[model samples]
Target: MYVIIVYDIKVERVNKVKSFLRQHLFWIQNSVFEGEVSRSEFQKIKNGLLDIIDEEEDSIIIYPFEFFSEVERTVLGVEKSPIDEIL
Candidate 1:
């Protein structure tokens, strides 16, 4: 099954994390990254990530959702939807 992994990380460290994944991963997107792999590969990716990230300098929160509904349920106001939407 396809899954969506959403991450919220520090602004400065975002680019470094994105760049690292782009080398070993496909389907890269803004803040959200998606790809398909075996269970073993998935575990390896997680471990590889931890090795490079510096906890004092940056932090990453990752969540794997089985369905789009779960993602939609957490939606905040859209950025372009309105000027006052976030206010």
Candidate 2:
């Protein structure tokens, strides 16, 4: 499945969350990540995030798609960290 994660975390834990997400997704923009992953990997990501975030201060939104093609992305400005697939 493909997942897009958008987060608004406290400054103290912001970098921690960012670093964790980077291991599983493409860092497209500030606090935004999108990529494909296996089911097990997805579970691991959620678990890891849960361990890092303080529920009272952090916010994370995850959008999961069965196929990447299903996401109709529109970039109006400079695309940061664009995904370039060679396949």
Question: Clashing residue pairs, candidate 2?
Answer: none
Root-mean-square deviation of each candidate, in angstroms?
7.5, 1.4
- Tens digit of per-residue lDDT, candidate 2, span 1-87: 999899999999999999999888888899998899999999999999999999988999999999988988888888887677511
Instruction: Tell me the lDDT of model 2 at 41.
Output: 96
* Sliding window of 10 residues with minimal summed lDDT for model 2: 78-87
Sequence-dependent TM-score of model 1? 0.51
- On the 0 to 100 scale, the lDDT of residue 23 in model 2 is 82
Local error of candidate 1 at 31, Å? 0.8
lDDT for each of the candidates? Answer: 0.56, 0.90
Predicted candidate 1 versus true structure: per-residue lDDT over 8-84, tens digit per residue: 56776677767766654553346665554466766776776677677776555555555534444334655332322
- Please identify model 2 stretches exceeding 4 Å from their true place: 85-87
Q: Work out candidate 2's RMSD over C-alphas.
A: 1.4
